[model samples]
Target: MVEKSKELKEKEQKILSNKTQSIYALALLIGFCIVINIIFSFVNFKIDLTEEKRFTLTPSTVQMLNGLKDNIYVEVLLEGQFPAGFKRLQESTKDLLDQFRSESPYVQYRFFDPLALVTVAEKNNRIKDLAEDGIKPTNLRVMEENESTEKIIYPVAVVKFGSKSIPVNLLENSIAGFSDEEVLNQSINLLEYKIADAINKILRVQKPTIAITKGHGESKPIETQDLINTLSPFYNLKWISLDSMYTVPDDIKLIIMPNPSVKFDEKAKFVLDQFVMKGGDVMFLINRLKIDMDSLRNVRAEYVPIENDVNLEDMFFKYGVRIQPNLILDLECSKIPLVVGKLGTGAQTELFKWYYAPLLSSNSINPIVKNIDRVNAYWTSTVDTIKTKTDIKKTVLLSSSQYSRVQFAPVRINFEILRYDPDPSKFNKPNQPVAVLLEGKFPSLYENRVSPDMLKTLTDIKAEYKSSGDEAKILVVSYGKLINNLYNPTQSDYMPMGYNTFEKQLYGNKDFVINAIEYMFDEKGILAARAKEVKLRLLDTVKIKNERSFWQFINVLLPISLLGLGALFFNILRKRKFAS
Candidate 1:
């Protein structure tokens, strides 16, 4: 009996000892967790294991976000049920906003579903209201059980700071021949710039003034309304005529000379030269060959392209580039409606590839055109960089494809070309540059040519004649209508720039122009964020289809089986240790 009582006491002591050890271990684990949490709270950092580091913000973006003084409220309209692709986008947006918040406490965001829990009528009204507010909707067709259903979703966000609110379209401009996955990837890549730019615009204290040149038969306000709308929020735009003024306004940061049909007088040219001499930037959207498409309204009509003489060739040659008097014909071109045959009283019209409207793209590493989609051009000519007296850095912003040929002025244009396919073998010329950016200290075109009387006249106005300009930049585009937006008579408002009405497609003209202007005025280096690349890692559909069951078993059964085995092993160890 005494021995039995001693054994019982020994067992009780052992149980007590095991319980005490377990309690100590639990306390130590809790303390260690607390320590880790404390360390993480003070040392804010994240590890990005992505090869592209897509989660890491650029230095410029980080600096900008860190400098925010007031709160920035972002409302993301991508919520509720969506496809895997859109869900990825939404998650990416949330991650980016979270990162922004981490950098600054003033950043705040909310995910909202605009159409959630709404009746049909209410949904339509809500969509209309959002559309009026500049938030466009995208239509998604979903297939379930072989039945197709359509859903409307808004891939947009609104950034509000202080009294300003601007709608940001989250979708990047879609490019032709790009898959939906690639487009989504590109959109994700540009999320940082799009959001940050909206914030920057709202925070701007003063907008730089941009002057549009008039009195040279340039594009009217109606023709370029879309471009105006795009830039009005960021810059102060004004119309200035070189014919009336002796010099461009001192406040003007840039001059946009769009498609001037009338030749510039010597005095006007001299004024422009002086403007460039004073460190002003100029965008020359000029056409070397003039071909009027209005004359092609008749089915059997033919037109000849003539050399357009705006008379700036000499000045452009001296500046380091020359717009060749020819039009680019590319195999990769836009399509136009043509009368293929007659179908009973009505003319059978079909879309035919128009080589005259070559789709221009760029492989240049310049930020202005980096990662930009193909720019739509009509009657675009070639640009050749010439050796100048001073050192000038020239970069081609747009060029033709590998199968392209140039047709010199006096070339015939008609419906006959559309009747047959273009011979690719004959189009041997490749990569013809249509737009060139020049940066340098340019010597004035009127350096020694200015008369003494003109110099005195300049002196009287306090505008000194500069023999050599300060460091300046110039964009010489051989296509003049590159900035012209299509005018829709039905709506009476102009369509967006780069919109092809026939094809119902939007090109990259608007983005390219905005990027160019931003790059020229980019002192903060914000435009560099556009060059950020997020590699698309897509799953192999075939492999997923074939190995679906195997992965499922491995993921589900393997974990449960291992867990059960671990429990069984723990029980056996306990029995062996305490059986005695």
Candidate 2:
């Protein structure tokens, strides 16, 4: 009886000892966790395990966030049920916004479902209101249990700062020739840029002045309405007639000369030179040749291409680029509707490849054109970089594709050419540059050519005639119609720039122009965010389909089997321990 009592006391002591050890371990773990939490609370940082480091924001973005003076509110409309791809986008957006909030107290965001818990009439009214606010809805076909249902979603965000607000399209639908998943990945890559840019525009205190040169047969306000609308939020735009003004206004930091038809006089050229000398940037959208599509109103109509005598040749050569009076014909071109046959009283029309309107693309990874869609160019000319004495960094931003050929001026353009297919053998020329970006100090066009009277006028105006310009940037595009928006008579409104009505496609013209101006004006590296790339990691559907059953079986049985074996081992161990 004493031996049994001693054994019972021994077992009780062992149980008490095990309980004490477990309590100590629990206390230590809790203390360690508290210390870790305390340290992390003071030092906030995240560990991005992604191979691409996609979650890491660019330094420019961080700097912009740090300099925020006012609160930025973002209302993301991409809420509620979605496919796996869209859900990934939604999660990424939340993660990015959380990171933004962590960096700055001024950043705030919320997710909202416009149609959630609403009646049919209310949902329709909500969608209409969103549309009026420029937040268009995207129709999605969702698959559920082998049945497909249509779902409408608003994949956009409204960013507001103070009284100003702008809608940001979260999905990049302009990308072509990419899979849906890849497009979504690209859209995710651009979210930071789009959101940050909108916020920057809204919070901008001081805006630079941009002058649109008039009296040079440039595009009218109606033609370039979209461009003006796009830039008005960021810059102060004014029409400056070169013929009337003695010189470009002192406040004008940039000059956009759009498609000047008439030749520029020597006096006008002098003003432009002095403007460049004063460290002002310039974007010259020059068309060396004229090919009017309006002249081709009837079937088999023709128009002869002629040299547009804008007379900026010497100026361009001095600036390190020469726009040749030739037209680029590319195999990769946009289609135009043509009368193919007569259908009773009405004319039957068919879409034909219009080689003259070359769809311009860039292989260079320049920030202005990187990851952007093709720029639509009408009667584009070729640009060649001249070997100049000044150290000018000339970068080609847009070029024709591999199957392209250039026709010199006076080439006949007719509807008859569209009837026959273009021969590939003839289109041997490739990568002909259509746009060139020059960055350096430029010599004045009127350095020695300026008359004494002009020099006196410059001196009288208190404008120093600088023989060589200060460091500046000049973007020369051979196609002038790049910024022109089509006017629809029936709608009585101008179409958006880069929009093709027939093809229902939006080109990169608007983005390209904006990016070019932004690149020139960007003192900070904020525009660099546009070049961010997120790698696409997609599952192999074929492999999953083949091994679905195998994986399912292993996933179901492995855990149960392990649990059963563990229980059996524990029972054996317990029995052995008690077996005295």
Candidate 3:
């Protein structure tokens, strides 16, 4: 009996051990499956509910990817500190590439520290054959500083499609040239486009190019580096110093002539005229007066009128604006400054008048200025609509406020001397035209000139895109300073309505620029950011002091008290059921 009992106990122990092992194994298998499901969830997650539905792609980017027969590699060559506010720029860039990766999973991306890798540096610096099957190489510069040597991101991104490879350069931020805020802002806006452009170029697709005229006192194409940087991401911007190369390239899309102080010679004029005749779009920004530092010396800032030997009267007459040999000054649209002199308060705080250069409101009706708020400009001219026979459609993109006035060329007024008291006799009307827009079919500059250059032809001062009879469209802003980039105003140096170089952001200036370009290129996606509209009204002190605090406190404490009561009840129930 003792032997049998002992054997039975041993059997019972073995059965318990087997049961425990089986239970543990089942739990592990369930836990493992749960962990694996979590892991796989992240890898193939789809944010878009309609993943199979077709999405619209930017025309250029779509073309590039479709054209690619092979693979392209994107190598980031950055390893160092960047300038102020550049971290955000890099993050935004990476975000854009991430978007592209999701769309084109085959696009290979890699990053190498060019500072540490000599082989990568050599490959980027060398001009290797990429266009045999049609490819282009791009170079990028990233600025960083070390203890001894300053390091820059000088990396080349090579795009390989079939036997062709194209390289593109990336910087902390910039298009082709360097930019200030305008360039930076634009780069941020078009990050998606830059990637598309890079990939497309690698795959060999036709890209539009912008040709900027050089010579005279036109801002050095480099100074407008900001301008070039913004546009280069979307269009291939080419600088054609008319002095050096008299010809405009065939692929040139828009020509920006901002405040050209000098005259255009016949050679230059001929090239411009021919280009326009070929359906080229032009943005004409010429100053009517010569601005000098001395002009601002007297009680009021003075200006010299511009005298052109070859007047674009005929062209402008057709388009509709006449560049009077005078400046357009407005009483309604003026910026106030701390006029250097004051009697009682010393530099008394008062609205030292500036002309009516009212901020242009974003016109949801028009695509060019769709979401653009305002461009900081002063002493802007009024544009008149010229009744033209051409079928080209025209639209006014900018204008002064209803209460505006005009200043003739010979007029003299000092912003410093305008006191709070009125001088009704000195200033003009309540409202006048500062700028207007004319769109329609434009005749060529050489149409009636003896070897006249089209670009300098100035055929339509009031109208834009005169070449495209029905298809051609032009955008004309009377003030050159709209694109001048004179200086951004700072808060201290700025008035309630002032132009501060350092302080003022491109609230609307950037939109105007990008919109103008997009309009010229006929791309509708250019202007989309909305201006901030905050409406705040402060309550009286008595209203704030009123006793709403008691009720407010009760509301806050009620939820917590309810939860505590429920917890206490649950504890009691647990004590009764399982406390034994």
Candidate 4:
């Protein structure tokens, strides 16, 4: 009896010790959790395991956001019942904004349904209000029960900082020749860029000023209204005449001289050359071969190439590039309406490949044109980088495809060329450069060419002339139609640049132009971030459809079967322990 009591007392003591130790462990775990929570409250930590680091923000974007002084309020108008594609876009937008908020506490966003009203009057009123706020709606066709239904959805976000707000369209409606699904995919891919661009625009101070030369036959306001609309928010755009002003305005940092039909006189040429000497950037959209498209509207359609008299050849040659007086005919080109057959009163027109309108492909890895879509060029001439004694950085920005040929000046461009099947042997020239970016110090066009007598013309303005200039950049395109907008008489509004009314598609003209300008002025690599791409991993739809029911059966039965087996084994083990 004494031995039994001693053993029982020892067992009780051991049980008490174990319980006390368990309590201490629990307390320690709770304390550690509390400390971690406090630390996390003060600091933000995140790990992105995605293959593309989709959750991570770019360094440039983070830097821009961190510099914010005021609170930014974004109203995303993509809320409501949407299809799967749009829902993906909405989730992406939210995710990107969340990343922004993580970087900067000043960023805040809210979702709103722009079409939630039931009454027609209320809906109209809401639409009017949204339009006034620059939030427009897009139409979508959804299929339900084998019936197609049209729905109006708003895919826009209005970002406001301080008193300025800019609208960012979530849908890439401007990418011509893309299906609805493709458009949405591209939009999702560009979500980060679009949002960051808006934020940068609103936060920017001291917007740069650019001049559009008007004395020559440059594009009119109506023709360039779309470009103006895109740049007005970030640039102070103006039309400066070289005829009236001897020198470019001091405030103007860049000049855009588009397609001048008339020749540049000596004074005008001198002013432009002096502008370059004064460290000014210029973008020249010139055409060497002048072929009138409107003249080919009749049945006997023939277009004879004429020499364009815009005299900037010597100036360009001195810089780096020479605009060849030849046109590029590419196998991969834009489409134009062609007459296939004649009906009683109307001609049956069909879309045919117009080799003259080459869709210039950008194989360049330059940030300005990286991953950008093809540019549509009408009567685009080829540009050659001159091998000069001076050292200048010349980069090819745009070129034709492998199956391209050069048509020398005075070549006949008639409708009959459309009927002939092009032989592959004829198109041997591969990657013909059509657009180029020239950078570095440029020698003055009048360095030794102009005489002392010509110097007297500028006697009124007493300024020392420099033979060479500081660092500058110039973008030269052998085509000018990329910036031209067509007029729609019925709507009485000008179509956006890069839009083809006949094909009802939008091209990459606007994006290229905007990106070029942005790249020029960008000191923080905002445009460089646009080259980021996230790989899309999608499952095979055919396999999913074929194995759907079998997968459903396995998913439904496997868990329950395993649970029953686990319960039986646990019960058996408990019984064995007790019985022993």
Q: How many clashes show up per model?
A: 0, 0, 50, 1
Q: TM-scores of all models?
A: 0.88, 0.89, 0.51, 0.89
Can you write out model 1's per-residue Cα lDDT over 251-301, one digit (the tens) per residue?
898999999989999999998998898899999999898765776664366
| Model 4 Cα lDDT, one tens digit per residue, 1-580 | 9999999899799889989999999999999999999999888898889886777777888888888888999999899777888899999999889889988899999998867766889899988988887678888898888999998888999999878999999887645455666667677767887888888888877888999989678878778888887788789998988877677778898899888888888788888888888888899998897665776675275777788979889888889889988888899888898779989999998988888888887877687785467888888888999975467899998899999999887787788887878887898988899899998888888887776766665665765566788878899998876677887657768888888888787778888898888877876767766776676566889999999998887999888999999999999999997696
Global CA lDDT of candidate 4, please?
Answer: 0.83
**Best-to-worst ranking by TM-score:** 2, 4, 1, 3
- Report the lDDT tens digits of candidate 2 across residue range 190-263: 88888887877777678989999888789988899888887886799999877776788888999999999988
Candidate 1 yields a Cα-based lDDT of 0.89
Candidate 4, residue 310: the lDDT equals 90
> What TM-score does model 3 achieve against the real structure?
0.51
Clashes of 3: 50
Better of 2 and 4 by lDDT: 2
Model 3's alpha-carbon lDDT is: 0.53
Best by lDDT: 1
Candidate 3 error regions (>4 Å):
1-209, 214-217, 220-225, 228-251, 262-271, 298-310, 319-353, 356-358, 364-368, 421-441, 445-473, 485-499, 502-511, 518-580
Question: Which scores higher on lDDT, 1 or 4?
Answer: 1
Residue 526 accuracy (lDDT) in model 2: 78
Give the range of the ten consecutive residues with the poorest summed lDDT in model 2. Answer: 294-303
* Candidate 2: regions farther than 4 A off: 1-22, 117-129, 141-151, 296-302, 448-451, 489-491, 542-580
The lDDT per prediction is 0.89, 0.88, 0.53, 0.83
Q: Which segments of candidate 1 are over 4 A away from where they belong? A: 1-29, 117-124, 142-148, 296-302, 488-491, 542-580
